[model samples]
Target: MRIAVAGSTGLVGSQVVAVAKAAGHSVVGLAREDGVDLTSPVGLDERLAGVEALVDVTQSPTIDIEAVKFFETVAANLGDAATSAGVSRTVLLSIIGVDRVPQYDYYVAKVAQERTHRVHSPGLHVLRAAQFLDFPGMAIRWGRDGDTTTVDDLLSQPVAVGEIARVLVELATGERDDDVIELAGPRQERIVDLARRLVAHSGEHLTVIARDVPEPMRNGALLPGSGAIIAGPTFDEWLSRQPA
Candidate 1:
């Protein structure tokens, strides 16, 4: 199969590309680094040529109206280009609870992306997964620098990025059921605990204060529901592999 992965350089997309190649599939990478901007579709038609499937794992850091517009544009461009290229299936990586709860601008953008694919490309497969275990590290780095606060009480099930990538490849090679598949980590842990574990793994001491994070930033919806697929290595297992 000829697979084209958008945002192939991102944390998750990069893994997807690796997994696809390891599975014996021909993979093409499309990203700004690869001279294909998904938001504009400037070189999409040429890049998507001979692509049997497209996995969209693109991301942007916009907020408010800008975020929504960015995803909407990317979705439109990808859908059109994939259709023109005779792509049979389109797979999208989405966050869990995008439609269940009222999240910030980014969630709205995700909803728009999903809707665009549904209407424009009916053969789309949407996979929703929980937050990555490394997400708390990102949050802490983006937050303050002190070691006084610990945020171990917030609920989250952090899945490994590699596991998510493998599942995506599985979906890519299978039929597109046009249904949403939900995946999560093997165990549930508080955000603070996860953060602390991550910090400890880095051989650093940092306090993760759990405050009333803004609703847009809170990942309450990332938790798995009853009977939802709980896949991938546990957080502690993944943490143990981190370099100190």
Candidate 2:
């Protein structure tokens, strides 16, 4: 099968491309680095020519209305071009808690993205995934203020990015009855705790503090349902491999 991956160099998309290619599939990379921008994209149909499956793992750099516009445009562009190119399968990567966090701007944007895809690509399959295991590191880096780092006191089932990528590739080529699938890590964990552990592991002279967030996230809104597929390198297992 020939697969085209949008955001082909991103965290998850890159992995998806690697997995597909390693399995002996041909790949067409659609990304800005390759002179293909999904938003205001040119020659998208040409790029997707002969692509049997397409995986959208594109990301927005912002979280406000701008983010909403970014996703909406990208989804629409990809859907139309894929349809024109006769792509058989389309898979979109989404966050697990997007529907649960109605008030959050980024979540709202994601919902809009999904809505656009559903409209333009009727056969789209969405893979809603839990927070990535490396999220704690990102949080700490973003929350840094002097020697203190503040993180949301949120519950999360942090799945490995590689595992998420593997499943996405499978969905692109395999048959499934459902339009949506949820995936998560093996265990539930606190984001703040993970941040503290990460700080300790890195020997960083920083204080990790847990701050309050909305009740939904603090409670369990981001968790996957019983039907969700669980995959690993549990957080600790993934962390152990990180260099100090």
Candidate 3:
């Protein structure tokens, strides 16, 4: 199977490429360095020839108000090209809880992408994955000056990025199911505790203050439902394996 992965140099897409190759598939990397940009498909049709499927894991460069518009623009560019390429299947990575709530602008854009794929590619396999274990470090400054670090008591099931990439290859090549697949970590964790563990792993000191977070991110809202698949070396397990 010849699979082209957009954003092939990114955190998720890179892993998808490695996994796809490990699973005995030829990969076409769709990135600027690869001489192909999905945002402007000038010669994309020529490149996508004989490609079976495409996995879109392109991410917004920023985490601000403008990211919503940026996401929509990127999705439109890639979705239209993928549909035109006559690919058999298309897989897109999405977030959990965004489809129903759409509380954040970025979340709304994700839903829009899924909807567009639904109309364009009938065999769109949507993988609504949970937050990544590496997300905590990116969330806030925790132990910069060895002081009390404040964090939300938001509960979430975060999976390893490598694990998510593994499943993406499975979905992209295994079958052409159009249904949404929910994926999450095996155990649920709170932000404060997760922060504390992360700091400890780095041999740092900081008092963790767990404050109340907003709705739809608390309790079991971010956890996967009964039918959702649970795949992991768990969050704590994954953290322990990280380099100090």
Candidate 4:
């Protein structure tokens, strides 16, 4: 099967490419680093020529209106390009609770992306996964304040990025299901605690301050629903595997 993966260089995208290749599938990795601008759709139509499936894992670092617009645009453009190219299925990596709660610009953008996928391509599979274990590390880096402060009080059920990629590969090759599947880690932990643990494991002594953030920014909408599927290695297990 020929699969096109957007954001193929990202934390999740790289894993998707690896798993798909390991499964003996041909993959077209699309990312800005690779000269494929998903936000523009310039070469997408041609690039998706023989693609049987498309897994979109594109993301932006900014959590603002521009990010939302970028996702919406990319989804719309990619959905249109895939549909026109006669792609059988397009799988989108989304987050849980995007629709139930309207907090945070990123969630709002994700909802828009989902809507675009549905409208532009009925043969779409939306997979919503919880935060990945590496997310805490990302937060630590992003929220670092000269080694003084970091974001805390947030909650997360972070799965391994590899596990999420495996699930995506499975979904891409299986029967087309125009449905949304929710995936999460085995356990939920406070973001602050997780960050602290990661820091301690790294031989760093950084204090994480747990502050009350807005419900939206706290990813209140990202919490998995009752029927959501939980999978993969637990946070503790993943943490233990990290290099000291």
TM-score, cand. 2: 0.97
- lDDT per residue as tens, model 3, 1-244: 9998988998888999999999899999988879776667577767777888888898877654577766666666666677677787888999878765556566767777777677766268889898888877755473344577677676788888888888788888865363688888888888667888887888866677776655777676677888787888786888878897
Q: Write the per-residue lDDT of candidate 2 for residues 1-244, one digit (tens) a residue.
A: 9999999999998999999999999999999898997897579999999999889999998867789999999999999998998998889999988899887788889999999999886368999999999899999988899999999898999999999998998889884545899999999999999999999999989999898877898899999998999999899999999999
Sorted on TM-score, best first, the list reads 2, 4, 1, 3
lDDT against true structure, model 2: 0.91
lDDT of 4 by residue, 104-178 (tens): 667778888888888885378888988888888887887888765576466667778887898888888875363
Work out the TM-score per prediction. 0.89, 0.97, 0.88, 0.93
- Candidate 1: how large is its RMSD? 2.6
- What lDDT does the true structure give each of the candidates? 0.79, 0.91, 0.77, 0.82
Which one wins on lDDT? 2
Which model scores highest in TM-score? 2
Clashing pairs in 4: none
Choose 1 or 4, whichever is better by TM-score: 4
Clash count list over all predictions: 8, 0, 0, 0
Give the range where candidate 4 is weakest over 10 consecutive residues by summed lDDT: 213-222
Task: Name the 10 consecutive residues with the lowest summed lDDT in model 1.
Answer: 213-222
